[model samples]
Target: MSRIQQRVAEAKAAGKKLLVAYIVNGDPQPEVTLPTMHEMVAKGVDVIELGVPFSDPMAEGPVIQKGHERALVHHTSLKGTLELVKQFRQTNDKTPIVLMGYANPVERFGYQAFATAAADVGVDGLLTVDLPPEEVVILKDALDAVGLDNIFLLAPTTTVARAQKIAEHASGFLYYVSLKGVTGAGHLDVEDVKSKLAAFGQLTDLPVCVGFGIKDPTTAKAVAQLADGVVVGSVLVEKMGSLEGQPAAAIATAVGEIIGGMRAAIDSL
Candidate 1:
């Protein structure tokens, strides 16, 4: 099974919520990004969604936009991001790494070559933002050839027909958008998420994870109580930005505090 699938199964068995952390691969530069990843793993992060620096991330919000800009300032690209993953494998292999980004970079890199390189560097899955279900079939085949899972993202606006189609192709896990707007732009509606989950679950057994605008322990805890997993990106990215001018230790320390609270929410459950 895919690591993400395995994680869901294990979390289900353990009656725990999956804690997913996301960060741009080279933002603040990989010098800090790599260690932050290892730090997250050490703090028991269930999965890591490393954003591949794409020129345009339409699905993302301002926080991630700024992160992409920061990553670009350091000349981060698809190939360089893959190299960071390769370096990550030198010390850790257990934490699942999902490359999340837009399809533009993958196309620019040549889809087949990018998938091959990502798999070679130990990436476990992918979450391409712009590649809708219709176009995903081709990329899915490419990833499957390399033994990688293609994670599909669903949202509130998704029709039953759309959800069903995405679920059919989804392998790693389904990322259910908790809100309608871009990442970090909306608030959680427990009732709404519950409603959507109920509706979407009718079509597929894939473990559903909710993200977008999830910011703190209260939100994370609430999501853990509802969804199978909770993904935090913009909040963490914002935290990274907040630690500016502080030493690397301060950066790591601040992140640990944020992750700790979110993790506590899951543990309390």
Candidate 2:
């Protein structure tokens, strides 16, 4: 199993729901990224979805869009993000790091070269927001060769047939975009999500993780009960955005507290 798959399996065996935290790498500043990563893991994040900033992040809401903008000011490229992951791996190796972003950067870096560098730097998975399974052959094949997980997203509007096709290509875990709108938009309908998850469970045994619209411990706990994992993103990114001029340790602590609360709530299950 890849690091991501192993981490998810361990959480399942222990009767615990995974808490995956998402943050834009080099947000506010490049120097703060590594410390914040370590702090999040210490606060109980099972998996780290480190977003590589792209000029046009179509799936992200205003909050995360601004995060990408801030990171871009510091010139956070895909190469720079990988360097952050390498630095993160120096002191910590167990927590799975999944690079989440657009396809352009990976393509610019070259598929095979990007995958090899990512795996060498301890990256566990890739979730290219715009890369659908149909067009994922070159990238997915590269990741497969490097033993890295190729993660995919399934939206609320996805047809049963489409989801089945996506499940066929997805590994590590499938990220279920909880909101019909962009990330950080809309409120979650717990019953609707529950029903959808039940239907998805019939299609594949792979762990299904819910993201987008999970903003607090209450929502985190609620989603934890239905899915194998709960992914909290926007709220944390919003926090990071608000603390732009603050010290790195303070920023890390602030975000860590959010994860800590959600962790407590998930563990309470």
Candidate 3:
């Protein structure tokens, strides 16, 4: 089974909800994003979703947009992030790494080559923001050939038919966008997220991970009650403003401490 599936299954068996964390690759540069990715897994993160920095991020909010800006200033690219993952797998291969970003860059890199490189680097899955279910076939088939999961996102505004289609094609898990706006917007209505989770549950058996706008332990816990998994990004990246030396983004640092506390909150429920 995929690490993602195994994680969700174990969470289900243990009566716990999975905690998925997202971070932009090369935020402080490849040197930093690499170690930070490892730290996240070592500290109790169930899965890692690394964002491939893009020029025009339609789905990203100001925070992640800022991340892309910083990462770009360091001159990081898809090749760099995958290389980081290649270096990452030298010691650890069990932790799931899903590259989340836009489709233009992937296509620009050649779909087949991208798949082969991701598999070669030990990447477990992908979540391309602008790649819809229909357009996914070109890359999805290539990914499947390499044994990589093509994870997709479903939004609150998505139609039931669209949701089913996305779920049907989804491999690792279904990333359910919690709200209508960009990531780190504001005030996520738990009831709205719960309603969306119910909708995804009706469509597929894939582990549903709720992301975007999850701010703290209380919010994460509330969403976990309905979601099979929870993904937080903006906050963790925010924790590293104006710092040096790995920026404390390692999963074992302050970010991990917060996630540890959030996990506690989920456990408390």
Top-TM-score candidate index: 2
Q: Model 3: runs farther than 4 Å from truth?
A: 242-252
Q: What would the TM-scores of all predictions be?
A: 0.96, 0.99, 0.94
RMSD to the hidden true structure, all candidates: 1.3, 0.7, 1.8
**Cα distance off (Å), candidate 1, residue 63:** 1.2
What does candidate 2's lDDT look like per residue over 1-269, in tens digits? 67887897899799999999999998988877888999999999999999999999999999999999999999999999888888888899799999999999999999999999999999999999999997999999999998999889999899889999999999989999887989999789989899999889799988999999998899999999999999999999999999998999999999999999999999999
For model 3, which pairs clash? Answer: 39-251, 40-251
Clashes (backbone N, CA, C under 3 Å), per candidate, total 0, 0, 2
> Model 1 over residues 35-99: C-alpha lDDT tens digits?
78878877878999999887778878899898888888888988898898999899987778999
Q: Which regions in candidate 1 have their CA more than 4 angstroms from the true location? A: none
After superposition, candidate 2 runs with Cα above 4 Å error:
none
The predicted structure with the larger lDDT, 1 or 3, is: 1
lDDT of each: 0.85, 0.93, 0.83
Query: After TM-score superposition, what is the CA distance of residue 59 in candidate 3 from its true location, in Å?
Result: 0.9
Q: Which residue pairs show collisions in model 2?
A: none
lDDT of 2 at 108: 98
**Looking at model 2, how many pairs of residues clash?**
0
Q: How far is candidate 2 from the true structure (C-alpha RMSD, Å)?
A: 0.7
